[model samples]
Target: MRFPGKVERHAGRARDCGRHFTKTLRRAALAATCASVVALTGCDDKQQVAAAGPPPAVAVTVMTIASHGAAAQIDLSGRVEPIRTAEVRARVDGIVQKLLYTEGTDVNAGAPLFAIDDSDYRAQLEQANAMLQRALAVQTNAQSVVARFRPLVQRQAVSAQEYEAAVSAQGQAQASVADARAAVTLAKLRLERCVVRAPIAGRVGRALVTEGALVSAASATLLAQINQLSPIFATFPKSNTAILDLMDEARQGGLQLSKDIRFPVQITLANGRAYDETGEVDFADLSIDPATGAQSVRARFQNADRVLLPGQFVTGRFRIGERQDAVLVPSRAVALNAGGASVYVVGADDIAHLRQVVLGDQQQGQWEVRSGLATGERVIVDGWQKIAPEQRVRAVEQHGPGPGP
Candidate 1:
C-alpha cells in the first residue's frame, strides 16, 4: 500500500542500520584485543621483577681477629688515705700551759707539742724525796740498835726475845725506805708526762685544745692528729665476681697473673691529671662485703711531692694480668641484648652473621673476646645495626691499632 520510492527509501535506511551495527561490532573486538595485549605486558613486568635477587649488599666496616698480647685491666674509683695516722692525746691531767708547735706543721717524733702545769707534780716529787730521806735516817738508827743489842744478847745483858724485836724493827725500816724510793720514781714519771710530745713523725693538724684548757689523762683526751703523707695509700673496691673470674682464667692458663700477685696500679686525680708515680697492690681484704659484694684493695704510692691528699677521690687503673692469645674488637661492635652480648661476624662470602660472644674485659674502646670467636674471623665494627643476620655486605676493612698482627 506504499509508493515504490517510499519503499526504496525505507530499504536504504535499513541497509544503513545494518552497516552501523557491523562497524560497532568491529570497534568492540579491537578494544578487547588492546586490553588483552596490555594485561600480558603487565604480567611480563611482574615476572621480570620476581626473577631479580635480594635488594643490595649493605656497606659495613669490619675488623679481623688475631692473636696479640692484651692486658687484663679494670678501672675503679679509689679514695686517698695516709699510710699512718696518729692521734696526739693528753698523757696527764693538768691545765694546758703552752702549745709549743704551730698548727698545721710537720714535726719529728719526740718533738714537744704541748706543756701542762707541773707545780702539783713537782710538789709531790719533793714530798716523796723528803719521805725517802726520813725513812733512811730511821733505818740507820734501827741498824745501830740491832748492832748494840746483838752483843748484849750474847753477853746475857739482854733477852733473846728483845734481840729478835730489834732485828724485826730494822727489817720494817728497810722496807719503808724501799717503798719511799718507789714513790719518788712514780712522782718523777708523772712530772715527765706533763710535757706532751709527738708520738710519730708526720704532718700535724689543728690543735684540739688551746692554752688554759683542761685535759685529762684518764680520759685520753685527743689534742691533735698527725698523718704521714710521703708514702701514701690509695684504697679501691673491686667486685668479688671479677676477682674470682680472673683467678679462674689464670688457673685455666688463659691468663698470666703477675708474679707474687702484686698487680700494678695507676691513678688519675679528680682534676683529670695522671699521677706521676705508679703504685703496687699492698693489701686486699680477706672477705667480701655483704652489702656491696666487693673486696677492698689497697695500693701504696710514693707521694714525694705530697700531691696526693687524704679523703680525695681518684680513678685507678689496675692491670692484674695479661692474655697471651687474646682476641679484641671495638666496643661499638658489641651489641648487648637479653642473651648477653653479641656481634656481627662477616664470613669469607662477605655475609654478615650474628654471633654470640663471651666478653671479658673492655679497654681503650676495645673489648676482649674470651670465647665464641676465633682467629682470622672478621667482625663488623660499623653498620651492624643497619644489617640483619645472614645478609650479604660490602665489608670495608678498618685499619690502625687493632687486634691485627
Candidate 2:
C-alpha cells in the first residue's frame, strides 16, 4: 500500500527505534545492579552494629555483708572537759608585781604563778613582830611581879588584894601574849600568800591581771585559770528512753549487757578523726534531766599527749553490750544526705541499686546496718563514685580495712 522509497524510510525509523529500546534496557540493567549492591552494603553495616552490644561495665570494689557479734552501743554528742578546773583568784589585797610563770604552761601544785607586792606585807610582818616582842616584855614583867608578890603574900608581907591584883595582871599579860602570837602567825600567812601559787597540778591559762594592777581580797579578783589536762572527763547526755530501750533489748536477748558500768568508750573529734586513745565509763546519772528527758553520763580518758582540750565538741560511743548476728559494712560504703543515710548495693546481675539504711554503732571501721539491708548482699565500698544506680558494674571483693578518699 506504500511507495518503495516510503517503505525504505519507515524501515530506517523502525531500526532507530529498536536501537533506542536496546539502550533503555541496558540502562535499566545497570540501575538494578547498583540497587542490589547498595542493599548488600546496608545489610553488612547493620549486622556489624548488631554484633556490638551494650557499653562495657564499670569496675568497682564491693563488700559482702555478713553477720558478726558486735558491741551494742549508744551514741551521743559530748564535750571534752577537765576533770578539775580551778579559777586562780587573788587571795590577798596587793599590787601585781611580777608574773612568775609563762602563760599556757603546765604548773605543779604549789608552784608560784604570780607575785604580788610583798613589801607592804613584809612591813606588816615586822610590825606584828614588834607588837609580839612588847607583849613578851610585858608578860615577863608580869611573871616577875607575880613571883615577887607570891613569896610576900606567903610571908604575909603583901596585902591579899595586892597578891590578887598581881595574879590578874599576869593572866592579862599571858592573854595578850597569846593574841599577839596569833596576829604574828596571821601576818606571816598573809606575807606568804602575796605570791600566788597553783592550788593543783594543771595547765595555767593566760594571766588576767597585768603588772601593777591593783587587786582586792574582799571582791573576787580573778588572776588566772588552771585546768587538769591528763585523765580528763568526757560528759554526754543520753535520752532516758534510750536507757530503757537498752535494758529492754538486753531482756529480749537482743543484747548481752555488761554487768559492770565501766564499759569501753570511744571518741571522734570534730575534725572527723577518731581519737587514738580509749576511755571508760565513769559515771551515769540516775536522775533524768527534767528539761531534756536525758540522763547525763561521764567517761574518763587519759590525755597523756595533751591532744584533747577542754570545751572541744566531740562524738562518743558507749559499748553497752554485745549483739549477735548483726550486719555490718565498711564505713566507706555509707553516704549521707538530706534524704538520709544510704549505700549502693551491687546485685548478682551486676546492677547497682541505691538503698537507704538505718545506721547503728560503728565497729572496727565498719558501720552497723540496722535496717534496709540483708546479709550476703554486696555493698560497694570503693569505686562507688565511678558508677550510678541502675548502671552495670564489675564488682570485685574488697580485702582491706576500708576505702579512702
Candidate 3:
C-alpha cells in the first residue's frame, strides 16, 4: 500500500490515461450509430411518399341529354274492334241445301255463301213458262179468227155478234199471255234468291244453320257474321280530366295539331310489346259518359296481316302535346329508389354527380325528363356502378337508343 512518491505519481497518471482513452472510444462509437439511424429514418419516409398517389379516374359511357322535341304521347288502355260488322241472314224461305263458305274464312262481296233448295223455285219457273206458251198459242188462234171475222162483219156475210165475240176472245187471250209473262218474271226472281251470297267483303264467322235446315225469309234468319279485318278500329275510353287537360295543353300551345290532321297513334299488346301496325286518331266523342265520366276515343289501324283481332285488349297511344327543349335519357341510365328516379351526370371536369330527375312518358328505350336536366348535358348511361358521387370519371360519347321522344 506504501510506495515511493515518484512511483505512486507515475501509476496514477497511467490509470487516468487508460480511463480517458476508453471514454473517448465509446463516444465515437455512439456518434457513428446515431448517424446510421438518422439515415435509415429518412429512407423510410421517402418509401411511404412514393407509395401514396392520387386516385385513378373511372371510365363511363355517357349520352348527351338533348331536346328531342316531339308531340307529347299519352297511353291509354283500349280494345281492338272491327271496322265493319254484318250479320249474314237468309234472304229467301227454303231449306238449306249447301254451305258454300267454310266457317271463319274471308269472303268477297256478292260471292255465294249458301245454297237453298231451289227445286220448287225451278219448277214454278217452268210452270209459268208453260202457261205463257199456252196463252200465246191461244191468242194467235183467236187473232186469226178475229181477222177473218172483221171482213165478214163489214160485208154482212156473217152476223155482227159473231165478229164481235171473236174480237173479245182475242183480247182475253192477249190479257192471259201478259199475266203469264209477269208470273214468269216473278218466278225467275224467286229462283235467283235461293242462292244466298255475301253482303260484304270481310271475314265470315261460324255458320248458324247446317245443310237441310229450314230457313224462313220473312224472319231475317241469322246465318253467320262477317267482320272487316283490314283497317280495324281500336276504341279507348279517356277520362274527362285527361280530356280537359289535353284541351288545356292545346290552348297553351303545348299541342299544335292541325284541325283536319289525324294524330298518329300506336298500340301495345298485353305482352309489353309494341304492335307492328300503327293507327290514327279517327273519332273522339264530344259527349262524356255520365256514368264513367270518360269520353270514348277511336283509332283506325291498318290490319292487312290480321295480327290484331277484334275484342283484344291493347294500350292505345297518341300525341296529346309536345315538349320543347326537353331532356331525354336512356331507360337504363336512370335508377329508382324510395326517393324517386335519379341519374349520374358527368361534369365537364370529368367528375360524377348524382342528380334527381323527374320522369315522364317513356319513349323508344328513352325516358322523357320533365325537369332536373338540361340540353347538351352528359348523362352516364353504361357505367353507373364504376364510381360514386363526387368521384372523378372518364366520360365517352355514345350513340345509344335515345333518338326520338
Candidate 4:
C-alpha cells in the first residue's frame, strides 16, 4: 500500500512538472515575439533616418552687378502753347464789306485781312482835300495883300489902322488853311483804318465775323485768332519746393544754372511717342501761384514742321544731373518688408541672407541703390518667397539672355 501511494505521488509530481515546463515554453515564445517586434521597429527607424537628407534646392533667377551710366531726371507733365498768340478785333465800327483771308490761313504782318465799306470815308477825305485847296488859295491871296499893305504902310500911302486890319485878315486866312490841312490828314488816317490788317505774322484761326455782318468799334466780334508756330512754348507747372531746391543748388555752385540756364527737355506726346525736336528751358516763374502753390516754367522748341499744336497735353522729362558710381539692380530683385526695401544676398555657403537697401530713382526698369548694396553682390530676383534666412540651400547660377546689339 505504501508503494502504490508513493507511485501516485510520483505521477502527480511528474504531471505538475510537465505543466510547469509547458507554461515556461509559452512565456518564452511570447518574449521572443516581443524581441522580434522591437528589432523590426529599430530597423524601420534607421531606414527612415537614412532616407531623410538635406532639403531640395530652390530654383531662382539672379542678376550680376554691372556698372552703367545713370541719369537723374525730373518727370513732369505740361501743355504746348504758341510763343505768341493774339486775338484779332476791329478798331472802328463799320460793315464787313469784304473778306480778304480764308479761314485757317497764314497771314503776314500789315497784310490787309478785311475791308469795310469806305465810300463815306472816301467822300469825307475828298471834302477835306477840297477845303484845304480853297484855304491855300485864300492864303495866297492874303500873302499878296500883306506884301502890298506893308509897302503902302511904309510909304505912308494908307492910314496905319487900315494896314493893321489887312495884316490881321491875312493871319486869319493862314490859320484857316492850317486847320483844313489837319482835317485832311485826320480823314486819311480814318480811311486807312477801314482796311483791317494783321498786326503780326502767324497762322490765322477761323474768322468770327462774316461779310455783311453789322460790326461796331466797341461791340465788334473777334475777327480771328493768330498764333506763332515757330519756336513754340511748352508751359509746365513745377512745385515750389522744387524751385527752391534748384535755387539753393545754384547758389551753392552745385549747378551751373546761371551760366547755362537752359536745360535739355524731352516731350512725350499724347500718343505715347516722343517728339522729334528737343526743347530748352526759356523762362521760370518769379512768383508762386496762390491757387496751386506751383510755379510755371516755359520751355522753347523750334517747330518748323508744325508738329506741335497749341494746348496739346504732353509729358516732359528733364535731366537734372548724373549719378556716378551708382549701384543699380533689377527692379524685381527689390522686396518690400516691414522695415523697408530689402534683397536676398547669396553668401559663400550658398545660403541666402536678407539685406536692407536704400533706393533711388528708377531707370530702364531698374532701381538705383543709394546705399546698403555693393558691387559684385548676387541678388535673388525670383524664388525669393520660397527662401528663408539661415536656411541651407543649393544655388544654381541663372543667366540672362544676351542683350541685342
Q: What is the TM-score of each predicted model, taking all chains together?
A: 0.69, 0.77, 0.67, 0.71
Instruction: Record all residue pairs in model 3 with backbone atoms less than 3 Å apart, i.e. clashing.
Output: 72-321
lDDT of 3 by residue, 242-329 (tens): 7777777678765654565477898999889988877898898989999999999999988988888889999988875576655678
lDDT value for candidate 1?
0.91
What TM-score, to 2 decimals, does candidate 2 have? 0.77
Task: Please identify which of the two predictions, 2 or 4, would achieve the higher TM-score against the true structure.
Answer: 2
Off by over 4 Å in 4: 1-61, 64-69, 159-165, 245-259, 330-376, 380-405
Candidate 4 C-alpha lDDT tens digits along 1-405? 358988999999999999999999999999999999999999999899889976677876666665555676677899999989988888777889988988787788888888888888899999999999999998899888888888788899988998888888889899999999999998998789889889888888887888998777787557888998887999999999887786686576444343455878898999999898889897888899999999888889999998888999998887766655667777777887678899888877778888899987766777888788777777777778888887655666555422221
The numbered model that scores best in TM-score is 2
Better of 2 and 3 by TM-score: 2
**Minimal lDDT window, size 10, model 2:** 396-405
lDDT, candidate 1, 1-405, per-residue tens? 759998999999999999999999999999999999999999998888888856889999987888889997888998999999999998889999999999888899999999999999999999999999999999999999999999899999999999999999999999999999999999999999899999898889999999999999999999999998889999999999988887898999988988765788989999999898999998989999999999999999989988898899999998987888998888888998888999999999998889999998777778888899998899888899998899999999986435422
Question: How many clashes (backbone N, Cα, C below 3 Å) per candidate?
Answer: 0, 0, 1, 0
Candidate 2 residue-wise lDDT, 93-212, digit = tens:
989999999999999999999899989889989999999999999999999999999989988999999999999999999999999999899999999999999999999999999999
- Looking at model 2, residue 105 earns an lDDT score of 96
- Candidate lDDT values, in order: 0.91, 0.90, 0.87, 0.82
Q: Evaluate residue 72 in candidate 1 and report its C-alpha lDDT on the 0 to 100 scale.
A: 77
